[model samples]
Target chain A: MGAGLTLRLRNELSEIRRLTAALDAFAEDEAIPSDVAMRMALVLDELLTNTIEYGYPDEVPGEIGIEAKRDGDMLMISVTDDARPFDPRKAPRPDLEQSVEDRRVGGLGLHLINTMADVDYARINGRNLVTLRLLVTSDGDGDPVAVAT
Target chain B: MSDAGNQVQATIGSEWVDDVLVLKPSGRVDSNNAGSAEAMILGQVDGGAQRIVLDMAELDYVSSAGLRVLLVTAKRLRQTGGRMALCQLRPNVHEVLEVSGFLAILTVCDGREAAIGEVTKT
Candidate 1:
């Protein structure tokens, strides 16, 4: 398991703030680049926001867990939510060439994730599990340069 | 005593550069504060400031949630014949804007002066 950490959150949307701080600490302890940590926080925030907003329309409590494990140079991050059986990968990709007026407000979350990391989604035991693999660059022992590789 | 660690200190400073409104949002903008930030910017529009230049010099982090606010603001500006410019993006912020194709549609400049000039020009 590579000394992984799991963060469990309630269905409340405000809990995402705690999630960000936890992910940042995890990245720091794991020696991942700071910028990659920011990206991880962003994608995870997107997933949790969607689940909280759409997954529980009636404001009911639910389960959401995020697990991160360091596998060599790659960071394996997974988010499990007890939201509806919705697949984020199935969402339509926003056409980048579209004009400002033609562009839709949402749909950029998964698109941004797809550009930076490899993602795998599964519906297991009534939970949506989304795992992402991020290739990170390290700076030996000092501060890592904020560049994605 | 303070809700400091639990939340990113997202704040917007509003200034009027003649007809243009230069909004400086410091700290991080994500799902937590995007909606409120959007409303604050839109509030400026309601106050009759059409042109806007987002001074992102101090904005450390932005996500798709923040990007959505910019997109929404851009679309709203266009409907009213107003344009917006962004300047002084940190590398991380710039990369997010570039990867999401916002640089193509939004007027991004190297400095606040250039952004102000660009937004106020047309």
Candidate 2:
């Protein structure tokens, strides 16, 4: 498997299916575990869905970019979109343990992404950029490289 | 139509057995079609079907958008004195539910028979 892969898709919800398939083939070639790959897919899917669904003001033509690479046993992933300058990392955490009646439906996506992966976000040059890193090794015995925003 | 993203277009099937409503949602449920999944389930709830069972044996993937649908549907059913049970989650979907602490709140069974029993039990 190559050390890096870049994917560009239009800012549309339909693009997520393509994204997941590419991720699946990459994970298979790289020999990443199914569980780990699913986690990675989950976080990225949530973030990208948010960007595609709510990022733009209308059906304006735009693009989102994803770059994933393996650094040692860690998987480094970054997603960039030229939508609104929103920072997902700073989003408020949802109450996970709240009673079902009191719980809200929509906020869990960001919460799940934050819980499953180490994420950092930045708005640079009028773009929304989010970076995520995951430990792909089963032993879970490596120090995570800090991503500077 | 095939999606460039390799996601199968989501499809939802429903059946009624006795007093329970059973939903079979196949393919990926993400932002693209979670609304359809939610609408199907909530529509049953709105139609006064109390006991609900989701047969997820063929469900290959689920994202946070999908999870939200399940949570919201479960909550809505509970408010109306209805019960919802899920069965046959794929490994990936199971893991997502587990990591999100959904196992604690949702009634999940090992198979369709168990799910039907759980939801239909007195």
Please, what is the TM-score per model?
Answer: 0.89, 0.87
iRMSD for each candidate structure, in the order shown: 4.8, 4.5
Highest TM-score: give the candidate number. Answer: 1
- Model 1, range B24-120, lDDT digits (tens) per residue? 9998898778878888888787777788999998898888889999999998889888879999898778878888999998999999999999987
What's the distance in Å from true for residue A81, model 2?
Answer: 1.7
The 10-residue segment with the lowest total lDDT in model 2 chain B:
B1-10
lDDT per residue for candidate 1 within A1-149, as digits (tens), equals 24777989987767888888888778878877767776777778777878887787584678898888888878888888888897777878889988899988888887887777788899999889998888777423223336888
What's the true lDDT of residue A109 in model 1?
Answer: 80
State how far residue B106 of model 1 sits from its true place (Å): 0.5
Clashes (backbone N, CA, C under 3 Å), per candidate, total: 0, 3
Indicate the TM-score of model 2. Answer: 0.87
lDDT scores in order: 0.82, 0.83
DockQ of each: 0.46, 0.39
